[model samples]
Target: MARPLLRLLAASCALGAMAGSAAAQVADHGAPWLENPFPSTYVPLPRSDVMLRHATILDGAGNRIDDGDVLVRSGKIAAVGRALANPGGAREIDARGRWITPGVIDVHSHDGTYVLPLTTIDREAGDVSEGSDVNVADTWIETAVNPQDTAFSRALRNGVTTIQILPGSSPIFSGRAVTVKPIRATSVAAMKFPGAPYGFKMACGENPKENGAETHRGPTSRQGVVTYVRKAFMDAQQILRDQKGEDGKPGPRRGPPAGRGPDLKREALAGIMAGDLRLNMHCYRADDMATMLSVAKEFGFHITAFHHATEAYKMPAALREAGTCAAVWGDWWGYKMEALDAVRANAPMLDRAGVCVTMHSDSPGSGQRLTIEAAKAAGAGRRMGIVVPPERMIRWVTSNSAKVLGLEDRIGTLAPGYNADLVVWSGDPFSVYTKADLVFIDGAIAADRSAPPASPASDFELGRVAAVRP
Candidate 1:
């Protein structure tokens, strides 16, 4: 992290008090702090050099190769081609009948944060949405992440290796998003993706406004929601301006008036302005999305993606022009008024208009079956004569989604020098009958069907094992 960014975070920590105990834990940042408070403790599992040969490969960049080979060495892809010379002593896997592709990346998920075993038990119901206020920018979703969430194991079994866990859409500014690798770990930090940038989660449309209305607070209408967002950004802009010196040099003479505590909300919102945090907005209607684009222009910050953008097809050109990705569900629609205009060909239309299109799973079940969800969208495209092939459609769950998280260079594709995060399927990945035979994370076998213990189970699942057996 840069010194300026660190100072910004320290200033944010100076807020008088936070909503919950989680923020209070990391509230005090003494001088000379050089590390993140919630730093990653993830270590790659033991792995060995391996060569998978004669498999059909979709490299996650709109290319397919048959009878191909993938060489994994030191937890990174060493080579990818046909008939490549294998440096001896590498374990060889005969994958002649299998299909290999980049591991599935779910851009929008609430797996760990929402958690399982929905009950009245403390913390078991999960800390999803903090409805106390409209802007909870100071909060982070990872603080409530339960590493023991059984959903991680289920997602691993279905070939998902990386997931960007976001806060729920029940607040205008929900919280910050955390990207994690779905691996067995003791702490949420152990699953955090190293070097991944943080994402700010914001929302528009029915969910936020309705939640506030039900709580008997303000912002019951769409205009009120927009007003809240605009006012927050305006405050953030003031913070940035106040941080600069009159002489245009670094000094305590300008930023925050020397001794006063920093505004945590504006500090976090400033991160988006400083280009340090990616902005992900949950929006559904076309008009609402366009309104967000205009706000982005006014504030000089980019909207990285529009999650659950059901009506993005209606304004594909605007999304493409803004270079914002439309992360949508495959076929989910009609559940609410804003989502009623969704079409099955939403993704295909965006693709046709040269927009970056990706698919997302906002639920646990959909997270496990992400590939088939992409297939559903692609199938809908085919019916509309859009003709998205398997090679390109695979990107909806892989590379394009990676782009949404701003980690496309490392984990999304099967290119040389990329992380060896991939999956081998029993058959065509899009086929409903096919399943992930093996899944690898950073060259380590995370799941294997031919071997015992297909995937590591959470403690919750382990306790239930006896009940499932005779």
Candidate 2:
């Protein structure tokens, strides 16, 4: 009755013996997001052409342009330069002392899905784990998101224009994650970032073991976790083998070949192998990440990003070469054993090594002030003699984050043909006293401090959420 053996026995019992036909279908039409049965219904709010002149623009491309003007027309950036031509009918704003940058993007967030049950404010079912069994990779976090959660509004006020809502990290494969626009809506579909690739959520250490081994459900150890993950992918591979050559038909099942319908769980794994889904693994330790990287290579898959990579500084050379972005925090660490190795200079250290670094707010409270979080990492870099200016630091929450989800070209930059999602700061964004004077998404005034809370204000925060600019 060893823990590992017991875990395998349970998995076999749960996913045991589906007919060959079901496995075939799973591998054939894999990656639901490509065909997207539930497509996004998001349309940018109505906006007029706008011209913001005399602003310091942190272009989100590691360049700073002072006293520049940005023009927005038709929900897209028309041009960016010093004294760009203002459209004839655009509303002009005198941003003489303000700083403008591409909107902040939080790559790792659980706001709408894991809504906090605040006594003052306001939080999924069954999405993180299925039947208390790990490896529920097929489930969708979007279906479980509560649009009414007040965190979205708070995140908006904090200048977060976009955030990816992730499932809890309790399972080794904690289902799928969806990127969302921080706008008020009745359904998660309305908030979905249109055409963004879905993210496959996987965890390596700590959370999964505590959930499975402690609960006697599955995977009691790190080795056991890897074993479980490998077997799942192998099962998907078997499906692929059977379905090959005879496209659209059922492949021969190993034992007796008799099952109906596609196995969503296996399809998700196949999506990863096929490179249709981006893998965002929640791994804190470097050794575990290395192991996961090996597993991915073995199965011919790629990791898009590593969440909470506190120990990534140790393996920067490999991570940089692999092109894996390390989504980290500012200074929140050392409260646990795995996090004891965390250093304030982790982000800069990794950046200096040519690795992609992004600052993430894993908590609802932290999601609001993400710029401040990135500033903390930048300050730590300065202390280490690694020169990081506001322009470069802005990428930790903007362009680099967009790159994590493969949405860099559209959002995350204030360039022509990109989404006109930019924020105007009352002062230097790195300072604690600065506030987002205006937040624009797709050229529309999403949050404007010039007036009282307007369109972006949710029903939940109509009276309480106010503009905070001088």
Whole-model Cα lDDT of every candidate shown, in order: 0.84, 0.80
| Per-prediction TM-score | 0.90, 0.87
Could you say which candidate leads in TM-score?
1
Worst 10 residues of 2 by lDDT: 1-10
Q: What TM-score should be assigned to candidate 2?
A: 0.87
Clashing residue pairs, backbone N/CA/C < 3 A, model 2:
19-258, 19-259, 115-123
Worst 10 residues of 1 by lDDT: 26-35
lDDT of 2 by residue, 1-470 (tens): 12232233223322322433323433343223234556799989989999999999999998899999999999999999997776599999999999999999999988776655543332132232343568888788888888977888778876889999888788888888899999888998999998787887999998888888677888989999999999998887654443333543322333213674667788678667766678999999899899999888787777999999999999998898788899999988888778889888889888888899998998888898888888887788889899887888888899999999889999999899999999999999888999888999988888776676555545555445677998
Query: Which ranges in model 2 have alpha carbons more than 4 Å from their true place?
Result: 1-33, 118-131, 246-258, 454-470
Against the hidden true structure, what lDDT does model 2 obtain? 0.80
The CA lDDT at 183 in model 2 is 87
Misplaced by over 4 Å in model 1 are 1-35, 120-124, 249-255, 454-456, 463-470
In the range 1-470, model 1's lDDT, one tens digit per residue, is 23454345434444412433323423332111111469788999999999999999999999999999999999999999899788997899999989999999999999877767777532548787777788888888899898899899889989999999998888898878899999989799999998787888999999888988998765998999999998888777656555444553222423365676767778788767655679999999999999999988877778999999998999988998999999998899998899899998888888878999988999999999988888888889889899988888889889998999989999889999999999999999999999999999999999888878734556778654445655
